[model samples]
Target: MKAVLPSITSDLDQAERDLREHGICLVSGVLSAEQLADVRAGLYRAAKLDNRRKLAHSGRRIDHGESNQHVRNTLSLDPVFADVAEHPAALRLVRSVLGWPALLGNQSAFIAMPGCEAGRLHADQGFIPEPWPTLPQGCNVGWCIDEFTEENGATRFVPGSCRHHRPPGEGDEEGSVAAVAPAGTMVVFDSRIWHRTGENRTSDQSCAALFNWYTRPIYRTQENWFLSLNPRILEGASDELLTLLGYKTEGFGKVNGRSPM
Candidate 1:
């Protein structure tokens, strides 16, 4: 019901606590100024290239004039993207909720262009059947590349909605609040939390965030790394990166009843 989510500056312990209590939290100053600029530039460049290649994703709400452009292949576009994906605090929080075997489900740019309609209110786990389990099966880490404000379409979330154990509906919009934070903050939340992009009222500024989704190992990943990952990345991937990508199989993911690694 508050105007914004709770935030902690450079405190991993508080971040985990916030996630458990509020279902969402912002970790400020997670990225340096240089990192912020580089990642932002990489996102735009990848988006431009994808647009040119007709591979960009724009979810059009025709009647509502929503044309949010999403760049889905950021992992293959730049090394900076990869660097951000492995951010220590972000990954640690992810593992704390989803466990050490959590797999990186998807990493993409969530951009709200000018005049865009607010995104539909729903939980990230909406795709899965309800009544949901008490423990989260997945989580989202949204890296704010640009300072988020109400005017420029910061993401909106329903605090403590994770305990609802189900997806939100039409009347659930009343208590939602925008996640307004400075650039370089990482907005992390449980998959069951109700959230969506707020409307972008600004004429020129576009709210951009790199969203890295992590899931429990049992679920299928949103992005198919085997088919979509760049060969160069695979060739040089560390053991941890490989594990995150599902290339390093564990108990259930074994190939021919044997570990891939």
Candidate 2:
């Protein structure tokens, strides 16, 4: 079960190399101190708004068994969230793993609270039936708003597991390591890698992580952008944003054989 730990680097070239060889890479300093602070605050603000709405309707927590809060459809929650999703650093890595025609599957907040239990270990592409292709069908970018540490529920990854063409089984957890990195780092990993959220053992601090997931254009996105994005956000989207949202026509997204864009 022994495996090499994921490579951590500030250089994109090194990160790309790690991704291809190790299945995971941590790109340090993807955000400035000020930017990280703003995103951290934005995450809580969005959580508060979502909580208020849920409380009004007696809604149960989406993460029922986990000691964490989930904020879905973050793009329309705040301007900062949209900025996080469209960050140049993230887009570059995503396209590298998932191809230029990648569509943003979703942008959401994963706030792991103190005492949170470790999550179910699995690959992001597990839904796709095996034998899995060598090429990844998706990529997941984790934006670390708070310093990620094993004590604070950092994600765990089984290094080089992306090379496995099939999903993990009963004993795969033995090889995993926590993806420790500083605040403002961006964690880019191939969706085929086996990963899970580590347990939060801290007394007070919550791990504020934002995940922007992308997929090949042939697959439908997790969030239905057409129905969920705020109208104003759509109106003001850049051409690249539109393309990521699946507004631009690729080979399969055509409407009656015509380009949607």
Per-candidate TM-score against the hidden true structure: 0.93, 0.92
Q: Which candidate number has the best TM-score?
A: 1
List candidate 2 stretches off by more than 4 Å: 55-66, 255-258
The true-versus-predicted C-alpha distance at residue 108 of model 2, in Å, is: 0.9
Query: What TM value does model 1 have?
Result: 0.93
lDDT of 2 by residue, 1-261 (tens): 467676679999888888888878899878878888888888888888867777312335433334677878888876777777888888888877877877888898778889887888888888898789889898999988888998999988888788886788999889789888888889988889898888899999888889998898888888888899887777777777878888888523788887787
Query: Any idea what lDDT model 1 has?
Result: 0.82
Model 1 over residues 47-73: C-alpha lDDT tens digits?
A: 778779876655553114435777786
Q: Ten consecutive residues with minimal summed lDDT in candidate 1?
A: 58-67
* Model 1 regions more than 4 Å off: 1-4, 57-66
